[model samples]
Structure formats: C-alpha cells, structure tokens
Target: MPLYYYYFGVLNATLLFRTARWRPPLLSRHAARGCGHAPSYGKMAARALVQYVVLRGDLRREPLSWPLGALVAQACHAALAVTHAHYQHPDTAAYLDQGGSMRTVVLEAPDESALTTLAETLQQNSIDHKMWIEQPENIATCIVLRPYPKEEVHHHLKKFKLLK
Candidate 1:
C-alpha cells in the first residue's frame, strides 16, 4: 500500500468510472513483472516527446517590424512544414499519436543570425529540422525541429527563452 499504488488505484478507478471499461490491476505493468519499483510520475513526464519552434523576435521589433499576425503565420508555416516533412519519422509519428496531449515549446531567437546559426548547428549535428524562408521576400523567419525527446535537444535550446 505505497502512496503511488494508492494514487494509481484512484486513477484507474476514475478511468473505469468514466470509460465504463475494464481496467488493469492496481499494480503497474513493471511492478506486475517483479520490478522493484515503478517509474515515478516525474520520470514518466520526462519521457514525453516534444517539438521546438524558434521564431525571430526582431521580426516584431523596430527596423524590420513585421505585423504580429505575420510573425504568427511564420511560426505556423515552419511548424507545419517541418511536421509534414518529417511525418514519417518515428519520433514525429509517436508525438502525433499523443493527439491532444502533444507538447510544443515555442521559443524566441533574437534575430535572423541567431536563427540561422541554430539551424546550422542542428544541421552539423544531423538533427532534423526545417527553416522556413518566406517566399517572394525570401526571408528566413522561423525554424522548427521535428518531434524529439527533450533530452536530445534541450541543451541546444536552453539559451533561448519562451516566446512572450
């Protein structure tokens, strides 16, 4: 009667009540297999897949001042393009399978140079990503990485901050 088992039982009971379907036993699959301990909630959360989108902050600032809607469109374009390009990739497939639970982290790069440098670094590392260069104007506005395990790409992105 560990605390996690109690919480797990409560969660299973709630699921059963809501879905009206048979649920598995209170012991987790790992525990049932004789593992000494089940993964902690924090560990489970760390396993989640995520996508990272870096948009240029300068686009919305003075000098090159693009409209807010336009910046949003750039992010959308980059995200969709990368997802479509890597749709067949295993990580992308698994991430998409999460449906409503899918996670995306949107960060801000100071300007074109930072965005391009990041893209180049990713390229050198063989990381999969797409850099969206807006047509007609041919400006590189944003970059999106295919869904990846956070541990695999977080170091490269730690310098950037979440878009405000």
Candidate 2:
C-alpha cells in the first residue's frame, strides 16, 4: 500500500501501545473512573454489567435487584447483564431464589433454546424484563428484567450516540 498509510498505521499502533502502558489519574477512594464518557443510561448500564459480572462471578447463579435509589448505572449494568442472554443455562437455577427482594433479574443462557426457556420462565413469574446478547466464552444471551423505567434510559440515551 501507500507509504503514507503504512506510516500512519505504525504511528497509530505506537500511540495505542503507549496509552495502554500509561497509568490513569486515580480518583478519590470512594469514586471510580467510568468508561471515560458522559454518564448516559447506556454507558451506566454497561458499567453495571461489568460490576455485576465481576462482583457476582456468574449472573446465572445470582438473582440481582436494586432499590429505587440505586445508581442508574448499576441498574443499567444489571439490565445489560441479563438481557445479554447468557444467564439462561439450567445451571443458573442454583443461584436463583424466589424470595429475593430484587426489582430485577439477570438471566444468561448459552444457547437459543435455553434462552427461550428462560424468557418463558420469567414471563410466567409475572416479572418485567429485557434481553441482551453477549459473547462470553461462547455466544450467549443475558436477559435483564424489571429494569429502571424506560424514561430514565431514554433521558440518558438521548445525549449519547450508539455508534462512534
């Protein structure tokens, strides 16, 4: 290809390498840096998922819910986690408990059939939910139910773009 394009590629690669090696400024002990973007509902939701996944280990094995005053980002995280469709595996039932006071649930499944079963079960429980698809280890889905009101999400989403 053109020499200019080759040099540009090399420069871009070098910058990425340097940034990856650089340390970010630490926030207060109580505050953590987010994904480096404005607090949109989608971004918040993404954060919640990462936190939930990291904290809970397995979404399928846990039933999660948040109080009304919980951070929207946390809600979004749980929402994104369940809707992702990976938490539907039958193995997930071990972590589920009927008496949990969750306003929402995150279901993850590894396959379409399992996801379908999960959706049906949630519907049967009279629980409100949403669906998300994720590729973790394998193609899977996570369904997040009883999400924060759509109004909250719409408000945040309006300020953000889904595509860069």
Question: Which sections of candidate 2 miss by over 4 Å?
Answer: 1-108, 133-140, 147-164
The per-model lDDT (C-alpha) reads 0.80, 0.35
State the displacement of the C-alpha of residue 38, model 1, in Å, after optimal TM-score superposition: 23
lDDT: worst 10-residue window of model 1 = 20-29
RMSD in order of candidates: 9.3, 17.8
Candidate 1's C-alpha runs over 4 A off are 1-46
Q: Where does candidate 1 clash, by residue pair? A: none
Per-model TM-score, in order, reads 0.73, 0.24
lDDT of model 1, residue 15: 38
Tens-place lDDT digits, model 1, residues 1-164:
42233554454344343453432342244346564444343543667788999999988888888999998998898888899998766566556655457799999999999999999999999999999999999999999999899999999999999999
Q: Residue-wise lDDT of candidate 2 within 101-127, one digit each (tens)?
A: 223322223334655565576577554
